[model samples]
Target: MTDTITEFDSILEALHQAIEKSDSAAAIRTLQQADHDQTAKLIDRLSVEDRQALFGLLTPEQGAEVLERVYYFQGADIIEELSAQVAAPFVAELDSDDRADLMNELDQADSEAILEELDEDLAHETRRFMAYPDGTAGAIMYSEFVSFQADMTVEEILNDIQTNRKKYIEFGVQYAYVLGREHQLLGVLPVRNLLFASRSQQASEIMIPKPTTVHADDTIEQLEDIFEEHNYLGLPVINKDGCLIGIIDRESTTEALQEAATEDLLKFQGLMGKEELRSMPLKVRSGRRLSWLSINVVLNLISASVIAMHQDTLEAVIALAVFLPIISDMSGCSGNQAVAVSMRELSLELISPKEFRRVFFKESSVGLINGACLGLLIGSLAWLWKGNAMLGLVVGTALALNTTVAVCVGGLVPLALKACRQDPALASGPILTTVTDMCGFMLILGLASLCLPYLV
Candidate 1:
């Protein structure tokens, strides 16, 4: 990872200098030395005119290769800048799944125009792949899987594979689907298995019958579960009528899951919808961020209102004011730990939304043990610092109570969101912090108010 970052930084610096000089040839030379992913990263840093200039320096095939390495939204932005005549051929050369993804990111009119420019057959195939709902297994699966009839002899299948070696290589063939009548999926034959089989053996005799399968409409989460349980290189995707439609390769599944995880991380950090080019206009980036930040402002005000309610208590015992942030911030940290665990459990399907009660009790137990230990330690320090027993008790008790509440709220909120068909990580940081702050303030100040005479 460190090496990759260093390489990216080096490439980015070189590209910046070349673009600054308006040296398209130098830029092209630098880009040619970099791989597709490196090129994609550099392209994102380029100004719109520079990006166009860079693309002009490459042939359509080189442009397509770099575009393929870029994320869907970034690729769409780049494609939109090109003329239809220039963009269409590039789009047509993309893998079917990638082409569909890019088109989906584009506006309907733009997508249609580009589709028209593609060859009739390629356009039809791209449209079919795009027909699946976003986030389903079908949407991400490749349609280039190799299949053989169950009755085909091993020799015959081998001959066909050798004949279309390039196509199989492009498809990343890991397994061959065995089909019955009407192209119904009968079994799966791993390529490794075929190598050991006799030349005279039939596919049906060697194939693994009733292989685990997923429907086209199955959610990516469901696909994740299947992938976790089985170590197959690819899983056959079937339609409602039980005929094979496509195959979901393990690499694609891994990539989708990783992207989902990254997205969740971004949403957790309140950075939603900001996955765009760094060269994106400042106003657009600010707008995307401000939507979430603005919502957070209102949410945080609720925590502030709690402090306002106890203004008198704060003024009487300024030390309590000093500890307010410490208590709240510490509890918030603990709560985030619980949130991380719950999010992982939810994503991995280790627990269901309905299992919230079980997770609640488990996290609460953890909170109780951790809170008691932390509370005692902080309470003793308060006594030594202020020489006030009541102040010690108030701060310590408040910390303990707030810690328990924080863990419970943290664990439950994500599950609650999942239950409501929402992203579990959506604004979770602000929501969790708000609740922890409000609860911590109420506990510390309310206690201080009751013992004001002793504190003073």
Candidate 2:
């Protein structure tokens, strides 16, 4: 096809025709003709089979370009589908951090096989990067940066940068760092200084001594705070021995945050192992979904048992049945809002698990206000429909009380779960739902039973 891929949708038919014909040349030509953004979107939307088919047609250089642009996990999936032999060359073209990311996401067998196929130095470096605990600065830091010994003359460093233009360009010259023999960071030389400094001066003589550094094992939260406070484009990362190893840039930290957010959203949806995709194995998709659905059945049954316990009150006042779900659902919505706020605060480190009293008081104040407002509205509705003041009061009071209970449970349960080191997102929704249902049922039915004489 001579047609250029301007829009992703326009290119799909050509790709399908090429794939169906099993023409690798046509497939690749079609891919090459497509716009870069369209190609990436096309890749993302393809089924696993189509993705593999299309990727298989790409040259190693082309494949590497594809791998680096897609999200890391998404790239890992592509690598996992390819043969270790076919994947390693493309992997070799990636920078150290990106290489480590793809390798880390591979299955053990796949990773080992791919590693074996890679250059010895590259393989070893990949393993070293993988050894960093996930969510630490080391795990996501860029291994590309320009560094020189403190003794190198400005002329010599400038000459070296010019000679290895491609290498330095990839390294992203922000500020040149000076290191000791052991590679301990000694100083930083702002790139602009080279314009004014004497060419004969040694790096240490002109460099700003003892520039800021972060340890490789530092947490991402620490990195976020550092970057936010300083507004620096990048910071040098060192090992426990204080030798420079990598660079932690604003881009890396922001990407880590985005990945964490995606993982949390999945966890909140009850996806086990914190990830799931339709393209994943059918068994994996089924099992992850069933895990939550199965527990939900048990929870729903428990709420039903509460209804069974109050069978007499429900029978006596048939109108109460209409409001049971309304109350539970409305309160559950309020409670989930509290849960969301608590989760956000915890993630931002604004609050800790031990601050139960603080969360309780804040949630209770809102709950009382919202509950009273909601109660009045529902109370008015009940009175108009049923033409009875006592019935309206009973229904309205139950909803109001249940709303308060719901908000408290929603806000507190997340903190309690955090204290126990459990996932608040996974447990909070079900906990809030079940508690609100049982409480709403008890309040309405229990109050109605007490005031039975007046109603009759």
Candidate 3:
């Protein structure tokens, strides 16, 4: 990845120098040859003046191609920088889905201005896409799918495809949808199948009926399952009334899943919402993190209070304080492992929230076995070091109990959150840490309090 980025950076630098020297032909030639993703990255790295100058150099159609492939945020930034008239042509040339996404990211006034400039059909299609709730199949699907009547013969379909090869390619046509009256999807015919079928056979005879489909309202997670289960190039998205609306290609579905994974990871780290660029204002960057940090401070105080309640015990045996963190840290590690397993199962839909009891029992059994082994090993070491069997027993028993509790909490918390329709990852670390710390400290200190006479 580093090498690829570095190579692109060199190409961008060459393009920049060409632009600076008033060599429009060379600049356009360099831009034209650049890979779509690489061009987007290079454009993002250029200075504002240079970026705008480069955009000015490309034809509106070429500009649209680049914008369609760029990250939506970066494309939005570029659109915002251009005058409405200048941006409209490029927006007009974009694929309906890409145009809609770009419009959704733009300011209302700017989006409206661009909409006014678009031809009526494209503008209407853009509105249709913008209307779907974000993160749904409808929101991400492309509206340019190829559809044919069920009665069309293979020869007819071939002739149609040959006549509009450019249009079909532009739509990324792979499997042609067989539609009935009122645009209701009936079946699907792969291009390869069409090529081999008898020329006189009707599409209805060749196409696969009742192909797997997704509803427009289905979430990205649901779409991910469909893609994983079926090895198809694209899946047709239908409306509640059973009419085909759009097509979600495998590439788009994969991208959505990847982006969702990245977002979840950031959320796990307490970075809420989209990632902020370093160039963003200081206040914005700090503001994004401040709320989560404040919540963590309150949660940490809960663990502090547990420690405070055991102050007398700690004062009696200073060594108890030495093991407090060790006990907490080790149990916390165990808890986190359980959390990761639970989250993965939930994401993969291998387990439902309602099956929490089943998950709990299975995780608890494993925890018990591991906890016993770890406790025995650590307990023997403590006895050897302190020459106090009771002290070792206290530490071992506390660790074992704490580990079991940690595993249960870690496994169940995510499911509980899912049952409540909350993000399982939200503040998971703080919640898990607080529980394990409080349990570990209470177990160790409370047991020590009872065994104080024996220790001295």
Candidate 4:
């Protein structure tokens, strides 16, 4: 392991030097020694100047390979810096799936400029997949899988695949899709079946009938469920009229799931919208971040208003101030847990928006037990700190009720937003934070005000 790490470090050092010097031949030589993934990581570590230099030095084929393997947003940043003529060849060299993914990440003007430079057929193919909305089956599927007519013999199909071995491998040709006269999916013929069956037999005679397929507009969540439920190697993507358009292999499904997960994680932390990279323009990055923070400022004021309303009660009992953050922070943590669960279930399609009652039942039961324990813990601390029973009771009761409300709100809010077609991941956090703060303040203050004489 030490020797391997040392070798990689040396390669990294050498690559950096070559790139810094703008020596194309030396950089290319260093790149040849490192694999695509290693080169991608190295590229990410370079300064913007060096990155552009290295990118320009790579051949279009090498550029396509790195772009296909690197993070999609980073690839977009690299392409965004290059001219249309310079980026076009690399975009064209990518597989149909990768071409669409890269184009989807780029700015509209840049994508259009690059698209114009591609050959007619390749450009049309890229546009066909790109036309689908993001996260749909059409967006993730490859256009290169092999297909044959029902009347074709096994020998004919085998001959074609053999004649075009490079294309078959490039397109991920595993099972030969059987199609009707109109390109409607009829069935699938496994490669093994084709190899073993009599060469003279027609494809329809040996194919597996009515293979599983997804519509072009279907969700990635649905694709994930089907992939898990069926454990199939690939699924056919069809249009509304049941005509097969392309094939989504297991790799594509897995990649889509990962991208969705990363996307949701970013949104959970208020980084909603397009994925951001450090290499992006300062104005654009700061602008995207502030868009959410600006809304957060408003939501925060609303939470703060609750405290302003109960200022008199707070002044009479200053000790209560110490526990304000404890209750809110603890409740926020509980609410976030509920949010995580709901987001997970939503991604898995395990729960629906209308099934609020089921989620409520589960979250509330957890809330009750957890709330009671948390209340007792904080209440004991309050009594310990002030040696007062009333202080303990007020804070404890407020915490208990606040926790219960927080979990319920957290659990149900995502469902409500999702049902209304809002982004549950992006909207859930601010809503949960504001609710936990306001409710924690209201419950603590309201209870303390009623018992202010004893608390003092």
Candidate 5:
């Protein structure tokens, strides 16, 4: 370990001392001395057996503070490891939103035990969150937030905050929402804004207008887009009736999005992600990967069949056979170039109907130019090696033509797929390779057959 590691270890040692001494105030003070990651490490270093003991040393409220400071998964791990009977009361003590997230990761028996331990209203709210799809805003949002009538004066809101500050702090309230008498969302006010507002101002006067709101059903992808666009720390969630339901903070969104994106990326590459693979046995992981590999094998076989069809032509002109790989390779490169550009454009939404024709023409031009240059270079090599000018010319011409065709096909196919509501990126690798292989084989061999007499 280096200086940083040594420092962190010392901090952990200090924390352990505090824990052993049953100094709750000292532990909280120790937390202030270290950074967030250091605090997380201290929490993680304590075994599951030590969690309740550690908590028992602190007040219920101080335990809540420590729990909030640790990583969510680390807290969940401790909760899961505790006997359900022992853990239930602990779970009941968590803020509603944190409880929901922790419960979701627990075994069914433990989850049910915790639910039974919760007050009726908290249990119902926690169940509502668990019912949402895992990757949606609803599932990630915290039910605990500050809300007050829009008509209320700032002084009134201040009084309410003073009354509920301790409860809100324990609940992890980051921002307060403004709602109508019927609980319809009107706007949002960050705690800073609330603290700075004039006492005489109405909540509506101080609250931000038309604040970004998320529907309960919005996907993690949609939430990511919104967060990226607005650079938000948090956003509110509402039901169909426009009633405030919950608020999704940056932490939850970040966690959910990282998992969701990893899953999507792994799926695109034909693999199960770390998220899905983490809990799985090695045998199961292998089985999942093997299925995708089998599909790739089928694709390769199709390319092989195309090669098998031209065996006779290959045999007659061994020189041509030697150069076939060059043709296919050139075409494949050109196709991949087109696929990459198209995918990037589509993903960024840079490709539009108005620009479609321009993009197609540009890619086709690029294909033709690249194909001709590569063809000239390869044809020259074939002529020098084989001592047959016609053979070289045929290979060169075929390469040039096929490259152009491959690129055009590569660009067009993905765009067409996108227009038809399919993902364009999916059209790039395997499908593009297949098209390039077939075209290259047919073009080179077909040219070879036509030029056979001249070579002989």
Candidate 6:
């Protein structure tokens, strides 16, 4: 056999032997080095006769951890590879979130089969989440949480916890929700409060009513803001009928924040939404990127058209052409700075109509100060290089004007977009660069044309 095949086969053999010997550490090491095929081979080897049988040999936690490691598709393959009897405990071993995620990934037939194998309650909850559009808070929340009747005494709840101390692992309750007789959510009491409360105290007395909640349909961004605002470890997700369906915990919130941040970053660069990029093939990625690139090329052509109008002046005074880059550079840099600041403010919801006057003044002041310093530097450099004081003066004036324009465009455009219900970060990248270039080129060259007679 060739060296590559020999190495691969040897690794597979070693991995199989390790698993057969119940050598967890050795199996882990082998898996760490295995390619997709080899990794699948290991799972397939253990699951050859009956996939669910593999779960019987591993602890629930270990099985859950291993399932997470495999690609979602591979996990599904393993599930199908197992018989119905074996798949039951394996599915039960997964936490609510993981189970929901897996169910959503499975085909309807497989999902129904698996659901039938699960406990009735767990099966129903998983199906509930699978019903939500992917990425919404409902799809991501955990159905397991601590809930107490409104009239339950603190002592009663404490006694229950003592009786069912092991239940916490399965329910994964970080905080307890207070509910009325019909299971309508009334308030929330943190774990800390419950522990500190008098045994005689009722849950209703200690719980905070009107606790923050998000509807199941709330977007991830909305959920993120609620979490940040409330300083919550998790927030309850309720249906329109005011029924508590699930809870969005801190872990899910963090994941949502990461995905939201990624989307914003991609949108800032004018890319398609994150979902498009995540599941798309390389060729699809290229096609989407090329489409945007072509649009930007048209914008660039507009900028070039503006520059071409001033070419006669540029040729007559080659020094002006040399000075052009300096002005454009300053404007683009200053505009980008303003755009970044504006986006930060917008993201934090720190800006509003009431703050508009102050924000504009602040941005304008920054622009003026930036323009003055950059204008002086570029003007002095041009004078020294071309040995023409008049050329320097004209270039400096144009630099200052262009810089001011660039800063204003950067700030105002984002604000305008926000006012029209558009994302401000979308105002960055090619759009910002193109605007600054067109404005800078016009200001500098137009001034140079007017000042050419005086200078030469």
**Strongest candidate by lDDT:** 4
After superposition, the stretches of candidate 2 with alpha carbons farther than 4 Å from their true spots are: 1-6, 17-29, 32-37, 45-49, 274-283
TM-score of each: 0.86, 0.89, 0.84, 0.90, 0.65, 0.67
Tens digits of per-residue lDDT for model 6, 1-456: 598778878887876676677676776677668766666555645534433444545665666666766655457656656666666577778767777777666667877888898889878877777788754788788877888899999999988888888977667677889998878899999888888899899999999998888888776767777777777788898888787878888777677667557767877777753334233357857877777788888988988987899888888887777777778887888888888787767655677624666767887888888889888988888889888888888888888888888887777667777787777765566777888788888887788788879766
- Model 5 segments beyond 4 Å from truth? 1-141, 153-156, 170-174, 197-202, 212-231, 249-261, 273-280, 316-330, 333-366, 373-394, 401-428, 454-456
Give the number of colliding residue pairs in candidate 2. 0
Please provide, for model 3 over 1-456, each residue's C-alpha lDDT reduced to its tens digit, 9 standing for 90 to 100: 999778787788889898688677788778777888777767766776776787788788878877877788788878888888888999988887788888998889999888888888888889889988876888888888788899999999999999999988987677899999788999999888898999999999999999999988887788877777888778899988789998887788778778777777888888865566664457867988997899988888998898899898888887787778878998899998998899888886789989888988998997898788878877888889889999889988888889998998899989989999888878566788899999999999999999998876
lDDT of 6: 0.75
Model 1: what TM-score? Answer: 0.86
| Worst-scoring 10-residue span by lDDT in model 4 | 36-45
Q: Candidate 4 residues 1-456, lDDT tens each?
A: 999788788888998888778787887788778776776677677777777788788889877877876788888888988899999988988888888999988889999999999998888889888999877888898877889999999889889888988877877567888999999999999988998999999999999999998888888878887888887999998888888888887778788888888888899888857897776678989999999999999999998999999999999999989999999999999988998899888866799999999999999999998999999999998999899999998999899989988999999999999999999989999999999999999999999989988988
Clashing pairs in 3: none
User: Number of clashing residue pairs in every model?
Assistant: 0, 0, 0, 0, 0, 1
Report the C-alpha lDDT of model 2 over 1-456, residue by residue, as the tens digit. 334534555677788888778788878777776666666666766888888877677777777877877767778888888898988898988888888888888899999999999989888888999889877889998777888899999899989999999878877778888999998989888988866899999998999987889988787888898888997999889878878899888998988988887887877777876366565678878988898989989988998898898898788888888998999999999999999999988877789999999999999999999999999999889999989999889988998998998998899999999999998877888888889988988898889889987665
Ordered by lDDT, highest first, the candidates read: 4, 1, 2, 3, 5, 6
Which residue segments of model 1 deviate by more than 4 Å?
A: 1-30, 83-85, 107-109, 119-124, 131-136, 153-159, 192-202, 219-230, 274-277
Where in model 6 is the C-alpha error above 4 Å? 1-141, 152-167, 187-232, 237-245, 250-255, 275-280, 352-361
Among these predictions, the greatest TM-score belongs to 4
- List the lowest-lDDT window of 10 residues for candidate 5: 272-281
Instruction: Please report, as a residue range, the 10-residue window in candidate 3 with the lowest summed lDDT.
Output: 272-281
Q: In model 5, how large is the Cα lDDT of residue 366?
A: 93
Estimate candidate 3's alpha-carbon lDDT, on a 0 to 1 scale: 0.85
Clashing pairs in 4: none
Question: Which is the better candidate, 5 or 6, if ranked by TM-score?
Answer: 6
lDDT of 4: 0.88
Ranking by TM-score: 4, 2, 1, 3, 6, 5
